[model samples]
Target: MLTFLLLRQLVQNAQSSSSSETVYLPLVTQPLIQSLPDAQQNHIQWMLDEAPYPALSAQAITVNLAEHEYLFLIGGGEQFNPQTGRLEQTSRVTRVELDENGQLGTWSDTGDLPHLPRRLHGFTATAVENMIFIIGGLNYPAGNSPIPRFNNKVYCAEVAENGTFDSWKARNQTWKINADTSYDYEESMAYHAAVFLNGRLYVMGGLRRGLYFSQSWDATRYVFSAEIDHSCEDLVWEQEETLPVPIRGHSAVAFERSDDKISEQAIYLFGGVTNDENDPTAVSYRANVGENGLEEWTPQAVIPGSAGIHAGTAVRSDEYLYYIAGTTQYDPKQNSARDNVYQTKILPDGDLQPWKALNALEYLYGHAAAVSTLGRLYVIGGAIVTNSTQMPLIQNTIYWTPLLFFSKESNPVGMVFPGEEIQYRFTIRSNNVRDLPGLVISDTLPTDLELVSAPNFFQNDRLLSSIRITLPINSKTWQTYTAVVTQPEIPVTINASTATATETVLPTNTSTLTAPATPTSTPPIRPTDDKTCVVSEVAPDSGTPRPKPTCTPTPVVTLSTTPTNTNTPTPTNTPTPTPTAMPTAVPEPVVVINVAELCFEGRCIWKSTAVTAPNRVYLPQIAK
Candidate 1:
């Protein structure tokens, strides 16, 4: 015991000598408390510095209609007819899936929103739990109508089983403008930002246009929070509080963080417009979510150069919030919002850290932004804002980014030639701050290739067409496959044609179309010995001649030379001519020409002779 105490004292003295360094003592005994002197602890902390965060490059992507995991840009006016300057609104639902890696994908169209396909814009789609609540946007314009009717309709869509988007169904609002319940808030406003936090839907900052308002438009300041009723079927809203200043075209993001002990959540507001404001508004405000209720709004950090960005959208990550492209209102006439992406961390003091530029986007307005559960940010359709167009010319373009902390690489750059043996390596390295799960990578080889060698970690036989890999977070692994390429052979095409006699000629020729049992090299000729035209034919009593073929070999030929007295031809016997020349190349199906001479212009032209022996078909001579 005495020796152990002396050694401990020596260790403490050594640690004290080095005040700039932090030394962890050994855990030799239970409940052994070790404390560093206050001065030394301070000095050690002063020497330490926080590590820089690793960032990956983001990519702008196009969305596809049939793909899943896409953030849907519900309804907006993009099909603008430049000729009439008439703005057309569509109820079309556009969707885009976020890539796990920063890669581009195309946007696709899906089923339209049910019910009347009203032109919808200036609305907010807030995802709460598994449901996306779209609240408050412009429904109809003053197209041959008395005034513009803003839609206060509330709709909610549940995420499908595989995380694909589903159809939205209308949910009736039980809340009203006044206690009398005569006026409904859901039917009167548009261009509002809505967010779902703490099991309640918060709708704020929208424009209500009607004849009742003095200026025909009201930038609503009243904030409304809605919660499901006991049956979870109907929504009950309460006009809780109002904003310090009501602004339209602003974006709000709800961020959940840890306060060391309890979970902390807050919503940050950035950029909007008031009635009198000339440019896009840049006011930043924050509201804290507490156990009892939401705290009062407090001013937070804004984007560095401008007041705030309007039309640009914002999405939240685990520790940071990203502000995407919107109209930059530094100049009202040239409100060109450049393609820009900015990010800021949610600090412990409930304040956002200094804004930093992350990526850039094409300038646009009237677009939407959404975030998937896997930290993918999607920027939906908006117009490319140049100094030229009077209206925000809409684009059907979508961009997506997968903010991955780790990096993946595959080797063997280009073409893998047939019969060439090669090795392919897939390496993944983790530089992420946190651990991740469901990290799967799938690779499918060409059909002809065969895998000869693979790592044991890569499961399956050598001939597997596809291999999937799932990696743990913050770890590195490599997979290699050695394969031999095998190219497939292509079959040749042949010309096959039918032989037919002319119909106008009465078809009197002995026409025989039969494939021979044995292939012949030359055309068939009549058999002759000296002056005697000897005829050799199959005997009538012959039953099933030897060397039978798939088709009977019938040949017809006529004697061209005059028959001498010693070479008289017999009635039942005919000499066999050589078989018709066999086709050298493979035969392909071809069109048959009429095998008849033209007797029309007073000239009766003929073809060849008739009767021959086995396996030969002959043509009769033409009398011209």
Candidate 2:
């Protein structure tokens, strides 16, 4: 019979190919390949030879490990082509592998995922296991304005040694997580914060879609809210705690250590926007979401400069978290990128500290990425902020900054006490007047700190902005002391005309004291010199006024050469009296530049000294 003959041929082929390793199968039953026309086949072959394309424009970071190193699996987000008015659905997993030798390489395409594309989701590898779990993201339409398509389902996958990846079937409803009572649509948010904590994955702060539709603008309603959920292995989502603020495009990192592990460990959050709508004025927050769903936040701390969405961050260790690139701020009304890189540190007390203006990335309003590896922080691809107002384009770039640990070598130099007068000085040198600078310094005063004296500072919009102020600290109130300095550019030039002598104030308690200006014509005063300060006394409790500091010993400006001209008269020399009625004196500059070799979360971080103009040695100028 035909079957008998085929079986005999198959056995013969197997035995014949046994020595060769690759055995051939009989073609008697399997379907044969359907050949196409010559021209069609050529087109198909050309398509097959092309390189793989990415599925999403903006995607989150996820990792799968092999042989102790990491393999990044990034995918799923929204993509739009403004020129073509073309919007594409993005939902696929792409792998970039770190090979056995610790080199980065890409793997060939495997297969499509079980689900379609969605944005703002959570994915993580199982603890001590080779399994990966992905849950909840919004599935938007494939067009310019995609909204309302939210994916609440959860999925998992495992990869084998042979480079084959297959997703596991959806987990059954072993545990169901319901929506938070305070939030109507807890499961619907994109670009929210998700982290694997304590045996469960915790999610917080995302937008709520589907509340408004184009077809029913009249019936429109707003349900923007914050949520935290755990306790589900499948489709069932149980809501836990509600976030104190609504946020999106935020990043979270978990700190795990053995000591006081239960309550002491925390998940710190950075830069994000509020609610579903985009507003540049919106502020960001930092909080701790406990295992029991209890949320606690530090007293409000604003992101110092221009805050933006989708910024990148790297957790160098437990205490120091660095934020890099992102759109500076979203003015949806204008639809442009607010590109800027703002970096700040979070104190152990859970405060959402302001971004330090001194440190900024090169590109502005672009989606910057970051990661900490081998004791250093690596920033990866993101768009740069350029003619954002004209033509916004995606940027493929890479940059990095070292995590400088704080040290006692560069300890903070200035301090303020309650109900006390303090003077701080800041100086700027310039080779050209066109080089403009701006500065803002804030002090963390005790609760009862008083600003009896207004800020008296010099600001030349065309040249420089510098200040030295003296403030009265309230003795009854107490808090940490802090300040910030922002300049148009770092490493300002020191020209011959610039004076190196800056005001110096000793710690003192006083009523109305006038300080005589140091003589510039004399040799510069040394730091060791003990000098007297003039006084126009006014009792603290009495209602009386006094004359301000006067021009005693006149100061002179001396140029190198004297001109021999008849028409031009020699410039007169007069001692310029210090502006006594000037607003509050600028605090004397005693910036604590502490360099510490700290061990944070089992890694070393070096905090470098804060220099004049440029705070760090190699940092780029902050793009306004």
Candidate 3:
């Protein structure tokens, strides 16, 4: 009996761990706090798990365009044990793909990397068109050999014609990987950072050596230095400003904005580990980092939630930068465990702030890679925490989120469909936004919507700031375009002064209902008709189908009585037909219209703000 019960328990456990089917986390009708317990709602968000290549972490990650997928150059080979499970280490490389449908592909091994495997390193794509740049990492030796290998090699490769990798070309000779030069402390650097900006790649803080013993403070003197030429290809080495403090296994982000038509600018550095990789509170900094040594590297703000490592990916959308994912300090003090996602935004003035939590990740990611297309940020696989030294199987997991903005400058896009005519009205409100009152509103419609009339312009001259414009649409089919409101740029190198122009359109539902009473100022209202009429595109079950109506249909009829002011017709007929005229009856037309679409600035849906009567139809018609 005891043996039978144990066997049954094993069977149940195996069933519970199956990944063949998805187990959904019960959704809250409204967003709720994670602490509040509802037994039905609790679930594990597992995006990636055991796969063929499980031991890879901290390898180079980049996108393969021809395949339209993401590839990870990981460390370690797969390890399997029937009793316990699979073990992943930091000695293998793996590739994760994202197809056109915005889904991640299965984990497949690319042929072995040209160089020996390593982990806890940093890599990023180059801005020189389409190339991937991989920097230094710690190489872990496999098998009976207890020797360790740390790589100072810098590799460069491009996505090529065939679907396979070209040879790994060396960009520069290897050098010591440390932190920004301004700090006095450093640790064994495993996970450092590198980013490409202004035609140069900037390397940030990370571990310089492995922490073998508990007393590692003396080992923290390594500072992260800037190296413009590690590849030996470019002999020019320039150091930007040092980071606020020494950080290892931390992430570096370089944000650029080119939409302003001005030169692109970058919002640099953020969170990572300091000298004590296992302790979070000990790794703190107190310096401000500006562009180059021209400005001091300062810690302006701390990331909001728990700090994490190997969890950073820098993504730029339009004008904002999002630093996402990583684990916190591995020890017990800072956190029970590091969460997988955090978000931060750069202010217009260029300052770093604390990170806020985003949606929970499926698993822990460190040393991951990312690429942005359209509006989604795609994060490839990294490592899940298994043990201190033991690397688990590299599970192929992909995670992402839509790029959303709450900025006042966020513009709604307009779209038109093929072969369809649509009229549009554009309105602007400047009641509260003083800086944007007089900005010009300009937009282009899709091919289907032809501009038949100039935009209707309105302004509250008394306010002196607010302005509005309306455009009549004649669109033919489905399409979309961006509606931009820009402050006129004046040529001014006069004082070297700069100001971010402000622009805002009013909330759609808040428009005023009142209009001026002048003949030219108000829209015409149709006269009301009280005649009994019933018309529908759908015919009644017992009635004959009626003729369809044209633009306007009138019912026709004859009256038995004649008014004194109106003409009276004489009676005539083989059977004396009365000719007294009453209101003329015109045949009302019945029209069948299909609502192919209803859209707003981007996507369309019915608005709850206003409602029209059911009696009204697109084409006017009289019912008999």
Candidate 4:
């Protein structure tokens, strides 16, 4: 039965497209193993041995070794033990290998964190090259002490090429207390976010629980940074700019933007609880990393339905930022675990577009999620709430799916006139760490538009409606096509066309992804030129030289007065001076054509000219 299920999954993956429903891997750990058949029990046991036990609030990171890529899952709160029927916390570390095709190998036990008697949770772990740094979190001591201890120590370890870790060494310099305060301001914090950017580790907002004086928890707005030394021994934390507001259980992700000449690195902060522990804020912020530290953060678009989100995981895949499952409410008795996944696009200017919903997951929170080098997203252990008892149930199930990055955009966003030729750029970006082969991009044009020229992939003169190209890892390839508007049939016609890119992988196939171009609309309006007009072409027999033209004026009328014959003319009385009829010399009809230049792909092309005659104006038929 296990073999059959695996075969079925492979078949489904091969035939799946991006628009189809998301396909999840089979559940690795099941809760009701004892009630199942013996064969089923054996299969469950086999999977459990290769997977981590049920836990929550763990931190995950992807490490790329010399030849293989591995995902490391660090400390988390093991909420339950079925054998003892008790709750537990763990300092255990596990890892899984990701194959070239983005398939996961069996999970292996790496080593447990040392030097601390208690297990930790709500901490952050970051990878700087081959070394991993474990930052502040809450430590749970053994035996009846229900209160969790806050920590300020920083731990560092080196990961070997075989995906094993060396002994973790504690840094000599730890988080320091503020000089003005009697107590530590943000030195000991948990449920915070940390990111490594440009050789520096940045720690953002988090919750600091009062240990000595009071048991109340307060959210902090502090930000700190440290320069990581080559030997990982002299790491020192330096305070940076604080956040606009205090927050906890948030997520932070940093990415480098090389779209322009001056490359920039940016950090984004997502949804979390504010000062009030139960109040989650949908507000997000973005800031650029500079030589000193982070610049002022600018508020971005608020995430929809994110007011209830906390303890979510945010990961960046290419140009997209994804926020995974998080708890909605602070109380354990409420249904706090959320299954929604929010996604947003990271613009070139380090701003974010509006957030949109993707496929939902199992109702869980405090899960660890990471993107493998092969462009696959993996969600590790989390906990779900029971409906009847409102108790939390820790889950060991692991789920993963492929991530696709592609976009289509039109150059002229606003108004497209009739007979106007515009350009459409289709960009395909590979988020994988290795090159992806056999990528087919298919574009469908609207009926009202005609394709003038497209990218020549085969070097042949013939035009192709679609293209097949290979995408280099962590890079983007774009192609532009010239299209002309044939008719302005409706008041506002949106050229909503889709382009699909299908990747063909061996052994395990990935899905085909589709991205539609931002709609280009053509509103009905009379074509008019705003600049000085020049005659581009003239009739053959007219013998008129091409020159800048002006609007012809109507012939002015004048009255001829007889001057001194004043007396004589007056005597004629007024025989209303018989006006002589003027003979009008008719000019030949000249067609005034307005020419505009359109450039694309470093080459300029002429747009169709509007022809106006002496007595009538009309749009000329553009030759194909």
Winning candidate number (TM-score): 4
Q: Write the per-residue lDDT of candidate 4 for residues 434-469, one digit (tens) a residue.
A: 245556544444555677877543222322334555
Candidate order by TM-score, decreasing, is 4, 1, 3, 2
How would you encode candidate 1's per-residue C-alpha lDDT over 393-454 as one tens digit per residue? 45555455433322212223233335666565444433221123334433444455566776
lDDT of 3 at 416: 18
lDDT digits (tens) for residues 1-624 of candidate 2: 343355456545555542322222222221121222222110111101111333223343434344333443344323345564333444555545433212345545646433333443222222213445555454545555534455555555565544346655455322233443333353444555556655556666654444345322110112121222332244344555545556666666665544453345556666666644445643444445555643554434555543545544434333445555455444322344433444444555555456544334445332424243332333433434345254343433333332221112111233322224332232221111011122222222212222333344222332112142211111111112222332211122222122234444444433443444444455433343333457674432243443454434434434323333325333334444443332232222221221212233323322122212112222111111
lDDT (10s digit) by residue, model 3, range 1-624: 232244345435544652322122111111121121121111212233333343334444455454354545454334433333322244344455654423456656555334332443333334233555556554444553333345555556555433245555655443343333332222123455666655565555554543445533221223333434423253223444555456655555555544454443553555566655554542323222335532445454565553545345555433344555555654312222344454445565555446555545644545355554433455555555566544433455555432211111111112212322333332222111011111232333322233333323222321111123221111111122222212111111111112223434333353334432334333444444534545544322223554454444344433323332343344333333343443332222111111112222232211101111113211112123
Error of 3 at 620 (Å): 32
lDDT of 4 at 127: 89
**Angstrom error at residue 237, model 4:** 1.0
After TM-score superposition, what is the CA distance of residue 275 in candidate 4 from its true location, in Å? Answer: 2.5
Pairs clashing within candidate 4: none
TM-score of 2: 0.45
